[model samples]
Target: MNRTWKNRGIVFTLALLFVTVEGFAQGNNNPPPKSPEVHGDQRVTFRIQAPNADSVKLSSSDIPGSMFSRHMAKNKEGVWELTSDVLAPGAYRYRFEVNGISVIDPRNTSFSESNENIWSLVTVPGNPMMDTRDVPHGAVAEVTYHSESLDRFRRMHVYTPPGYESGEGQYPVFYLLHGAYDSDDAWSTVGRAGFILDNLIAEGKAKPMIVVMPDGHTGPFGYGDELPMDEFIQDFKNDIKPYVESHYRVKANRENRAMAGLSMGGAHTLGIAIPNLDEYAYIGVFSSGVFGLVNNDGSVVEASETAYVKQNSEVLSNDDLKEGLELFWFATGKEDFLLDITRATVTMFEDYDFDVVYEETEGAHTWLVWRDYLIEFTPKLFK
Candidate 1:
């Protein structure tokens, strides 16, 4: 009986050893998946194993111009791979489409979402302007405040620069605004604003200040629809500005306050900040301008060269407007669709002797240009 039991034990141990060896061999045969691989030259290669998929395509946020989609090729291993051209160093959003259905990269964990879409994110390092450097980083906090105008609790992302916790002095504030179809999180997530500011402040290129990104949408309007400008501006004044000033360590003065925005937010800056110049000393309008005026009766009045000048005549003609403002900077990409309107607005400002620093770079109205605008604009603040 002892001999029989010992034989059974040996058989069980041998069977366990054989199963372990087989599992190890199988694991070695199948390598781990690597979806996004950033190359040395800033090009990125994305791969996905979709054996059952009939078709696969790539959609990346870094695509220049109007083309946002690219066709990907599938290999014999049922892996779809596509290498992007040399891209700029920044964070980008991308995803895959399998048989006409959008899907996130299964291997990538980082992602960002707008009101309409969810996209996988990839950070291409090596650019210090946008990259996270070995510097003292700031603290970002999401704070909620009650909005009297909107009659709801709105949230904002605030970035306090390095040494803010131990520092004693109140810093200047930059009320940064996001574009349409985006939330308050857009600046830090896709824009990389916090990292950009960190690098700038470390290098002494930008002043250590607080950046407040507020939700520009005041009403329940879908993407591409005109926002409630009056309500948004009122809320910013009545709710957001007061809340930020009372909560954060910020200088509550016009000289220390600045306002800037991109796209629809830029339009809001024009409509809100220009009239309230006493509130914001520095104003930046990027890739957008006053397309039209919102009447009290909620009517849309198309902006004309004459009408623009006529409506803002007092503000444009006032010598104090230019003298009081620290900077009135506007920039737009040369290929941006709104370049003509930006040019018209710049012309209007120049015609009235308003000291507006206008810039035109080589790109369209995308986050790339907006990020560049933030990097350039932040350095000029509180100087």
Candidate 2:
């Protein structure tokens, strides 16, 4: 009787152990492991549990040394994983292509939508310039106003510095602009201009000021058509400026007003701000494909005796105009496709003997370079 009872107990214990092991195996097959594990040195590891997938590829945007499509290795547990090299500090968008179909990271919820493509977003921390530190953040408001130029109610994003509401002092204004095919929120969302300014102000690196980002697109037009530069300039000057100055406690004068932009908006800055030097004390042209100076083939168009060039030359030649100008800044990436044009523009400024601050850094025509430009440019403004 005792031997039979001991045999039964042994059988029961073995059965319980088997059930636990089976449950663990089922759980392992149920869901994938944590993905996008950002490490201390900025290296990121991505994982996905695709037991039946034939192939997996990882695609990313703006990650240095990243391949167009990196093959992921699958483990015995059917878990596919790939570790990326140490990346710079910035927000990056990525996606996994499982058997030719793109999908977002199931484990990561952060995402960004551009056109129709949705990409998983990951931000490697440690960039103080772009990071949102424990500081007094400014208020970003979506303002809607009737555009007399477009004959519609357009929206803009305005960033009022911390203490702006309580402070009685009028602050200087920076008329920030976005590239083509982007809305006014581009500066706040993608460019992160608000956080950049917050950290700069908190650390005493930049003066507390208001930033106005306006949409550059005017009228119902598709891509490839010439942007209505004249309409945009007039609306900015006649309509947007008045609305901003009236709504916010801003110093509405040339000495306190500054304008800067990137890409197509940079071209607009060069066209609008440089010619209207008396209206803007500070002008920043970043990665601007200077209209006549840059050709369609990315070659430098020689300084011609065209009316446009001649007009800019005349405006920059005046000592009084140059002296009145607080800051005439131009910056571009060394590897930018528009580098030749930027260099030519600088040469034209030099030829005119204008006091221009030209900056060149190692990067392509991307938001990473533009963020750096904003950090360096803001400190030099309204000083």
Which is the leading candidate under TM-score? 1
Residues 194-239, model 2: lDDT tens digits: 9999999999999999999887767644567776687888888778
lDDT of each: 0.79, 0.78
lDDT of 2 at 9: 46
Native-to-model Cα distance after best TM-score fit, residue 321 in candidate 1, in Å = 3.4
TM-score for predicted model 2 compared with the true structure: 0.80
* C-alpha positional error of residue 271 in candidate 1 after TM-score superposition, expressed in Å: 1.6
Estimate, for each residue in 1-383, the C-alpha lDDT of model 1 and write its tens digit: 34323643453344334323443544434553487999999888888766556878888665542155787887765667888888887888877777776677767767665544556788888778999778999988878789988898877899999999998999999999987777677788888999999999999999999999998877556855766577888988889988998988899988999999998889878877777777789999999876644344544444443455566667777887678898999999999877877877777677678788999998997888898999999999998
TM-score of 1: 0.85
**Model 1: CA > 4 A from native:** 1-32, 219-224, 293-313
For candidate 2, give the lDDT: 0.78
**Model 1 C-alpha lDDT versus the unseen true structure:** 0.79
- Give me the displacement of residue 296 in model 1, in angstroms: 24
